[model samples]
Target: MMGRLARQGGLAVGERIRFDGQVRLVLAVTGRAVILSELTSEPRLVPPAALFADGDFEIVDISGRMPLPPLSLLETLPQPVLEKALWWEGHILEILHGQAPDAPQGAEVRPEYAPTRSLTARERAKAGW
Candidate 1:
C-alpha cells in the first residue's frame, strides 16, 4: 500500500510527471497538496490524492535529489574530521530516535536507578523537553 501511494502521489519538488494531457512539473509539496505547473500555465496546488486519482498520470523524471552540488567535492576530509562527522551523525540520530544509540555487542549493561544521580541537569533538561 505504501509503495502504491508513493508511486501515485508521493511527488517531490522538481519531479516531472505526465499529468492530464501534458507534462507537468511538481513545484512543491506542502501538507496534503502538491503544487504543479507546466510551461504554458501558472502553478496550482492540488490535492495529490485527487490529482493522481484519474487521467494520464506517470512520473516522467525525478529531480528531487539533484546531486550536482555534492558531486563537486574533489577530496575527502582528514580522518579525524571524518570521525567527528560520523560521531555528530550519531548524536543527531540519537535525538531523532528519542534514545541514545545502542552499545556494541557485549557492552550492554542492565538499567540501574542511581538515586544519587537523580535530578541532575541533564536529567532535568530531558524531563523538561
Candidate 2:
C-alpha cells in the first residue's frame, strides 16, 4: 500500500480511503483529502494515501500471489511497470470507495458536542496540539 500511495504522488481529491475497518470516500479537504467514516462526524484528513488504503481487510492467503519478475526481484523496477502498478492500486481504491455506505441524507449530522476546553501552555507545547 505504501508503494501504491508513493506511486500516485500521494492521495488526491476523489481518492478512496478506509478507517476503523470500514471503507470511506474522500470528500472535501483543508490540506489533504477529507475521509468520512460511519462513526465519524467531520471528515478527518489522513496524511498518506497509503494509510487510507490500508484499512482493515481480511488477510488473504499468499500462495497464489504472483511472484515478482526475476528482473524486478533483482533490481529496481522500470518506470512503466511501476506506473502500471500505481494505476492498478488506484483502481482498487476506487472500487473500495464505491462500496462505502452512502452518506445519510438530511441535515448533515452534527458532530457530538464536546465542551470546549481552554488551551494550556503545556498542551500548546506539544506537537500539533
Candidate 3:
C-alpha cells in the first residue's frame, strides 16, 4: 500500500511505473528528481510531478529486470559528454608526458588538477578522485 506522501514523492530503485505509454524502472532518486530507464535502456531524469500528473501512471507487473544501454548507444554519447572525454584524454596525456598536445593554455586549471604545483602533488591530486 502506498501512503499519500509516497504517492507524491519517492519511488524505490527497482520499482517499475508506467510512463508515456512505456513502463520504466526507477534507477535512482533524489530530492528533486527520479531517474527512469525504459526497457530499451533509454534513461531520463524526470520531475516527480510529471509521474503523478492526472493520476496518469499505474503500478504494473514487470519482470523486474533492466539491462544497461546498448554498447552502440553508450559509444555515441552526445557532443557535450564527448567533450569531457576529450578533456580527459588531454588530461591523461598531460600526466604521462608532462604536457598535453592541443591543450589550451589553461587546461591545468580546468578539472581541479594542479599540475603546476609539483609532479608529486599532481599525482596525489589525480589519485584522490
Candidate 4:
C-alpha cells in the first residue's frame, strides 16, 4: 500500500519536505513518488525529478493533510520557513546570473587626475616679461 511504502521510506503525506532547494508540503505519498506543493503565496506542483530518494530534505515539521490549511494560512507559518524561501529566491537569481551569493554591488569611482594643459603665451609672459 502507498501508506505502508511511505512509512517504510520514513516519509508521509502532510510532512514538510524540501525539493529543488525549496521547502514543500507533501500532499500525497505513493510507492514511487510524492506530490508536493511549495510553501509560498501561490503554491505549485514540484516536478518528480526534484524529489530525492535519499531523503535529502530537512523535515520542517509533521502536520498531516487534515491540519494543513489552504493558501490563506501561509502567513501563519514559522519564521524559518519564510526565511528559507527568501534565501531560495535569491539563490535562484544568483544561479541564473552566474554570480556569487554575497558579491558586492559596484560603486561609482572618482578619477584621480584633474584636467591640465599648457598655459597661454600671455599668461606665461606676465610671469617674466
Candidate 5:
C-alpha cells in the first residue's frame, strides 16, 4: 500500500508521514517513484518499502507549522546587538515580533570601536620582575 501510494504521488513535499513508529517529512519524489528526503535528525532517502509495511502507515500534512529561521549562534545575542549587527536579524525580528527596531533605525554600527585601556609602568615592572 505504501509503495502504491508513493508511486501514485499521494505524498506531498513537506508532508509529515509516519512508518514503523518513525516520523519523517517527504521532501521530494523522483522518477523511480521513491520518497526522497525523509526527515530524521538528518534527512535520509530510502525506499518506501523499507519505510512502510504491514499496511501500517500514517501521513499528516504539517506544512502549517510555523517556519523557523535556521538556527545559529546569533540567537543568543541581545536584541539590540542583533538588530545593530545584521540587517537580516532586524527583518527576522520584525516578522517574528511584528514590529520594527525600537532602538532608532538607521543608526550606524561601528565594529571598530574599542574601549581604551590604561597600563601602568608599575604593573609592567611587577610582571617583568
Candidate 6:
C-alpha cells in the first residue's frame, strides 16, 4: 500500500514506469526531474512536468523490480556536457598548474587565478598540484 502511494505520488528508483507508451526504468529522481533508462542505449533526465503534461504514464506493478545501470554508467552526458566538462577541467588544471598569465607581457589574467598574496608558481605539474 505504501509502495503504491510512493509510486503514484513520488519518484522511486528502480520503478518501471510506462511513459509515452514505452517502458522505462527509473534510475534517479530529483525535485523536478526523473532519470529514466529507455531502450535507446542511454538514460535521459526528464522533467516530471513534461511527463505529467503527456498524461499517459502509469505506474506498473513490476515497479521497483527492474535493475538499471549505475548513474556513472548512464550515457546521459551528451557531447555538449562533455565539452563543457572538458573546458572546466582545463581551466581548473591551468589554475592548479599555476599556468597563470604572465603579468609583464600583457597576457590576460584568468579571472579565477588573479595574482594574489598567496601566489605560488608551478609548471608541468600534474593532478596533485
Per-candidate RMSD, Å: 12.4, 19.5, 14.9, 25.5, 19.3, 17.5
The C-alpha stretches of model 6 lying farther than 4 A from their native spots are: 1-9, 62-129
Please give me the total number of clashing residue pairs in predicted model 5. Answer: 0
Measured on C-alpha atoms, candidate 6 has an lDDT of: 0.54
lDDT of each: 0.53, 0.38, 0.56, 0.45, 0.46, 0.54
Which prediction has more favorable TM-score, 1 or 3? 1
* Alpha-carbon TM-score of each model against the true structure: 0.44, 0.29, 0.38, 0.33, 0.34, 0.41
Pairs of residues clashing in candidate 5: none
Candidate 5 at 91: error in angstroms? 23
Q: Candidate 5 regions off by >4 Å?
A: 1-9, 33-41, 52-54, 62-129
Candidate 5 residue-wise lDDT, 19-124, digit = tens: 6567666764433343545444556665655555525477755442224456487778898877576776554333322233443544432222100111232223
- Residues 12-123, candidate 3: write the lDDT tens digits: 5557778778877777655567788856657888887776662547656432222223346535898888778767866654543344556555344433333234444555
Which structure is stronger by lDDT: 2 or 4?
4
lDDT of 2: 0.38
Give the lDDT of residue 90 in candidate 3. 62
Per-residue lDDT tens digits of candidate 6, residues 23-118? 888776665687899796788888977765555677764432232224462346887886686566555435432232222343554444432212
Candidate 1 lDDT over 47-85, as tens digits, reads: 867777746777888543322234123238777776686
RMSD of 4: 25.5
Task: Give per-residue lDDT, candidate 6, residue 65.
Answer: 22
Candidate 6: pairs in clash: none
lDDT of 5 at 107: 45
On TM-score, the leading prediction is: 1
Ranking by TM-score: 1, 6, 3, 5, 4, 2
Instruction: Sort the predicted structures by lDDT, highest score first.
Output: 3, 6, 1, 5, 4, 2
As a whole number from 0 to 100, the lDDT of residue 105 in candidate 5 is 46
Candidate 1 residue pairs in backbone clash:
none
